[model samples]
Target: MPNNKIGGHYSQAYDEELQQAVDRLVDMGGLVLQQLRDSMAAFTTADVVLAKQVKKGDRQVNSFEVDIDEHCLDILARRQPAATDLRLVLSVLKSINDVERIGDQAKRIAKTLLKDEQGSRPSAEQLAELNGMSAKVQLMLQHALLAFQQIDADKALNVLREDKAIDDDYSRIMQQSLSAMMHDSQQISVSLQISNVAKALERVGDHSRNICQHAIFLSKGRNVAHLNDDELQQIVEKKRD
Candidate 1:
């Protein structure tokens, strides 16, 4: 249903404007990636100062989202993009929002980590699990942004595949955390904070997957949003061949 191309262009200036919108979107995505990196580091290292910095950086991320949205609207209203160009514009519009949400998740992780008192900190084992989960989600975000930059469906599908693993990690972390809480009621607050951070990481993974889906839509002209892993794999393989 969606075509991927800049068709029926009125002028070179209009085409450049559309491309600029995409460039700006990519820039915003980069800011989100940085925020995730900083927030994860703060969570693992117990750096409240770095956490505070992440919270402050959220405002810039929010601004990027607004600016990109406005740019997309301007192109749609004035330039009236069609075909592949229209698909690209629509994908960028959706992805900006997704990136913004990822930024919010980073902020949430930072806030939760900052609230944790010294003696109430999660055990090293729990922190290790959180670190591993954070690393995986950060990788996902990196690759998702790369998929958008290259418009590579294969890369996007790879991100889609990663979502399941992150989900499993979240489940395992929660289960272990709950077990720890049961053994020591005094650790309940720490366990809850760990659980919250893990949940935030899971949400970042979900947003990364959404960005990958948008990349697939932009590149393949197919709506793979609702497709399961098996279905997505089939589509991806067919495209590769």
Candidate 2:
């Protein structure tokens, strides 16, 4: 049955405005993604100017949060959309906080790197690995946001699966940093910064997982996180069988 109970809804003329709002939210997500990537770049290159740019970007992303919140509230107050329509508004309202905090984590990473006295880069191999992990998490975030907007469960599931790979990558980074720390007393400070950055990347991976989880919940009413990959694969196999 089609929902026909819309109250005080804007006419068809407002469809474009509503879509623009969603686009702006996605744009906000994009900005955060770039910040995360650039933060890592700043840390890896010991570029204080890059870190400063990231800090500046933090303020801008916060403004996006505020603007999106106001627009969502306006939609709610005026349209009073119910059911899935209401759900979309509320889920976005909730998800933006996670996105904003992800930006904050990037800011923290930038600040930490800016404090480095030696201005050294992380080892080439280690930096490459970290870059790979960062790319994965960033892509997952982008896919999750797109999935939310498009109600694409398959894309959401892919984002969920990608988290494990990010975790595995971070684990290796941790082990390597820990080994480096244990071997050289003089390297203690650098090792500490490296370990913390790895942990922050791991945290961002967790947030990506959370975003995908909510995407599944909002779009399909599925709680995908409760199942392990093997268990989930089995569930899918059985359904196909």
Candidate 3:
């Protein structure tokens, strides 16, 4: 994703700076992925300690967003990057915001899990559904970040396709949880918590899609923001044509 041609001025310092920015972005992505994993594990195990740690780790994710944005701004001001280089920086800036929000969503899941220690927890079947949803979301983010790193538009589109499955899973989880709550009045609080977690997982998929959208923008320079599935597929088809 590093563009070497910026008005033909290929300073070593500029190249290093740009590369470092991308490295930070990758690091940030990895950190959020870990946060998601830890948060889900904490919830499933009902480990208050791990949940607390996940909540505390959100600060590091926030820091990475701030640092990366500053570096991008510095490059824009000093290097005045153009063409692909400019696109790279802009995409990184936008994608990092999504990554940070993913971390926040993970943190929210952890907080919800830890909200009530004395109350009943989710049933095993519910946890399995939640874990499945989390796995899909985690994979989506993983692919999105890889696509971002490689500036691979096809990979980004594939991530978009995966989002639909996750959405379906989220809807199924919500339905199951709601049905369980209706059967047992005591299950209301725990069911609500699971619903919130499912919603957070769905939002994570959304943020991952946003990252992939930025990747597409970086690769094709065709601002595919806010487009639906069919529309995005049409754009890809047009590019292929």
Better of 1 and 3 by lDDT: 3
Candidate 1, residue 150: lDDT: 77
Candidate 2 ranges beyond 4 A from true positions = 1-10, 117-121, 222-241
In order, candidate lDDTs are 0.86, 0.76, 0.89
lDDT of 1 by residue, 125-178 (tens): 888899899889989988898888778888999888898899999999999889
Candidates 2 and 3 compared: the better one by TM-score is 3
Best by TM-score: 3
Candidate 1 to truth, TM? 0.91
Which candidate leads the pack in lDDT?
3
State TM-scores per candidate.
0.91, 0.85, 0.94
Steric overlap count per candidate? 4, 0, 0
True-structure lDDT of candidate 2: 0.76
Model 3, residue 147: C-alpha shift (Å): 0.2
What pairs collide in candidate 3?
none
Ranking by TM-score: 3, 1, 2
Candidate 1 residue 113 Cα shift, in angstroms, is: 2.1
